[model samples]
Target: MVTYRSAGVDIDKANEFVKFIKEKVKKEFNLEEFGGFASGFPIKGYKKPILFSTTDGVGTKLKVAQAVGVHNTVGIDLVAMNVNDLITTGADPFIFLDYIATGKLDLEVMKQVMEGIIKGCREGEVILAGGETAEMPGFYPEGVYDLAGFCVGLCEEDEVITGKEIKPGDLLLGLPSSGFHSNGYSLIRKVLEMNNVSYEDYVEELGKKVWEVLLVPTRIYVKEIKKLKKNVKIKGIAHITGGGIPENLIRILPEGTKAVVYKKNIPQNPVFSWIQRLGNVEEREMFRTFNMGVGMIVILDKEEFDKARELIPESFYLGEILAGRKEVEIL
Candidate 1:
């Protein structure tokens, strides 16, 4: 007689793995009263509070983690993808929950994954309230795992920074990215493998193993942007991800206001160039798939440019909002 364990799922091992992660997971909790049936938050003082939430996954970048046998940083990617989006609406991320599904239980791997999640949550100033981990034998391949995260944040209704305030003459400020933050991997993997390049190989420009460049953890922009929000009048915040500059930035543009991006003014990271050459990818396609060095953008009136500049020194004047169709143009 065949059993679930024989089919590559080990129920006992999966339960044991959860038991091991309880301690590590508890480290993200700050509640003094620990025995609640549901996650709790105390909201008392705000006159008008607005709640913001988002859910996201790391995309096919998990395949890169599985390829390189690096399980931890992907967990950070999982959290960063979700919480970063929550902050775009000027929300203060308050709590996060994760979902992990795998073919079998690997305690060591799960521990490292949880550690990264906890570290990411702490950095974002949010609580890791709860999560679910599932082991499905027939569903996933052995050694492969997938992760997704849900985030909730709070802000006052009047304080929400929707793009409604954006108008012509507003300055666009870009924040530099460490590298590609969990997008465009399907094409990247295809090109690299076709060229017989392995993660172990070092490219001169990257200055480390290829996998290191591929696995650069996604940047958490919540802290920096939160600081800027306090002192600057930000009209809109755009988190550059899968849709790249034009598509992503235009999401927050008000109708009749187009964002004119000066391509020359935008900085290009070497990895982007390398990928372009390797994949023979078109410039337009590259802009649509990757962050292309600028990971997040802030839009505010031209009058606030100098003040906003002081708050975010790394930002660059990418371009301006103009009275035109709701489109992004490269000048």
Candidate 2:
């Protein structure tokens, strides 16, 4: 007779992992039925609540974390990616769930990853509702795992920002990013590999090792967006990801209006310059691949620009809308 354990799946280990998670999050989050088939969260305090949901992964940035033996920050990256996208719709994220899969469960590494996730949830003010941990011996290589996160948020029906009000003469404001926030690492890895550079190698320009820069957790803009919306009539919002500014920002532009981003206005991250010099990447590709420096963009009326600055001192004047095709231009 064949047993389930003989097939490489360890039931006892998975049970223990679940128990560990419950113990860590029991006090922090008020999820009484976390281990059940599904988690529950009560929604209240909205006149006409609109639900928003998003899911995202850490991308190849995971490789850098694994290579560097840093497993914690990637969990934060997972939460940031999902929550940041949810906030782009001007929603308040209230619950978060994660799925982690590995060949053989490494309790210590998974624990570290959970810690990071908990930290991100706390920072974003989202509840750690529940999640899953899958252990398949033959499915994934030993000591290797993948992570994905799901987030649910809600906003008042009247408060949803859909970029319908965006028009010519509106000003664009940008929130600076924390290095390359969980995107374009595949190209980054390629650049390093082709040049025979290791993640452990130090780059003087960046003042840090390669993995250090690569593993920088993505910024969670939930709080900042909430603060700005109360004071400014935010016409549009964009979370710069996978496709740099042009691809992400264009999604929020109204018809007949285009965005022009002044290169001079952008405070480019040093890592981008180093990558360009090392990989001989074109300027257009650099802007297309990386966040450059700006992580989030807020579009509002020109009259409100001063007020926005007072609220977010770190935000810079990015560009303005123009009467043209619905698109984005990085000058």
Candidate 3:
């Protein structure tokens, strides 16, 4: 007689993992119940609320985390990717859910990942609603796992920033990224392999080991955007991710307006320069692949630029919008 445990699927272990998640959510989010089929929270304070949802995964960056035996930061990356996108519409993310899957259960690793998730939720002011932990025997390797996150946000109907307000003469403002911010790791790993570089190896330019820089948790822009909203009238916002500035910035432009960005003013982070030197990557490819440095771009009227700058001192004056075909130019 074969049992589920004998077949490498331990129902008891999965139950225990669910209980573990419940405890974490209870402590972190002050929830009285968890492990439910669906999670929810009541909404308030908006006379006319519009709901926005976003889903994203950490992508190949998870492989790097597994390689380095660090499972925490990627949880933050998961939340950052989703919440940042939701906020572009001027929504306040209120609830977040996560999904984790692996070939076998590892309690300790899951716990560490959960801790990072809780931290990220707290920082983003999102509730740890609920999540799923699947242990699939044949689908994944024993030590490898994957993560995906879902975020829901609420905004007033009149307050939604649809980018329709963005027009010619609006100034582009760029907020610096924490690092790579969970994109382009496939190319990064390939570059490392071609250079015969190890994640443990330290490079002089970046001032840290490869894995350390790569593992830097993506910055959550919720607080900064919220603060800026109070003082500045932001016409549009873009979260720079896989497609980089050229692809992301163009997204918020109106049909006839174009964006012009000054590459010289981008304040290229050291890691990008290192990757370019090692991989011999072209400038265009680099901009299209990585954030280069800016993580979030905000569109504002020329007159409001001074106030927005005063609020976010680290922001750089990227460029201005102009009348043209819908596209982007990085000079």
> Which digits, one per residue and each the tens of the lDDT, describe model 2 over residues 1-331?
7988788887887888889889878878856677888877778899899999999999888888877789989999999999999998989998999999888888889999999999999988999989989887888887789999999999999999999999999999999999899999999989998999999999998889888878889998888899999998989999999899989999999899999999798876898899888899998998899999989999999999999999988899999999998889888
- Taking all chains together, each candidate's TM-score versus the true structure is 0.94, 0.97, 0.97
Please identify which of the two predictions, 2 or 3, would achieve the higher lDDT against the true structure. Answer: 3
Query: Residue 70 in model 2: shift from native, Å?
Result: 1.1
Clashes of each: 0, 0, 0
RMSD of each: 1.9, 1.2, 1.1
> Which residue pairs overlap in candidate 1's backbone?
none
List model 3 lDDT by residue over 53-125, tens digit each: 9999999999999998999899999999999999999999999999999998888898889888989998899
Screening candidate 3 with a backbone cut-off below 3 angstroms (N, C-alpha, C), the clashing residue pairs are none
Model 3 weakest lDDT span, ten residues long = 33-42
Q: Candidate 1, which ten residues in sequence have the lowest lDDT sum? A: 28-37
lDDT string, candidate 1, 1-331, tens digits = 9998887778788777656556665655745533334577788668899998999999898898888789889888888999889999999998898899998878788888888888888778888887888888778888988898999999999899989989888889988888989899998998898889998999998688889999999999988888888888889999999989888998998899999988787777899999899889999999999999988899988888888888878778888999999999877
- By lDDT, rank the candidates, best first: 3, 2, 1
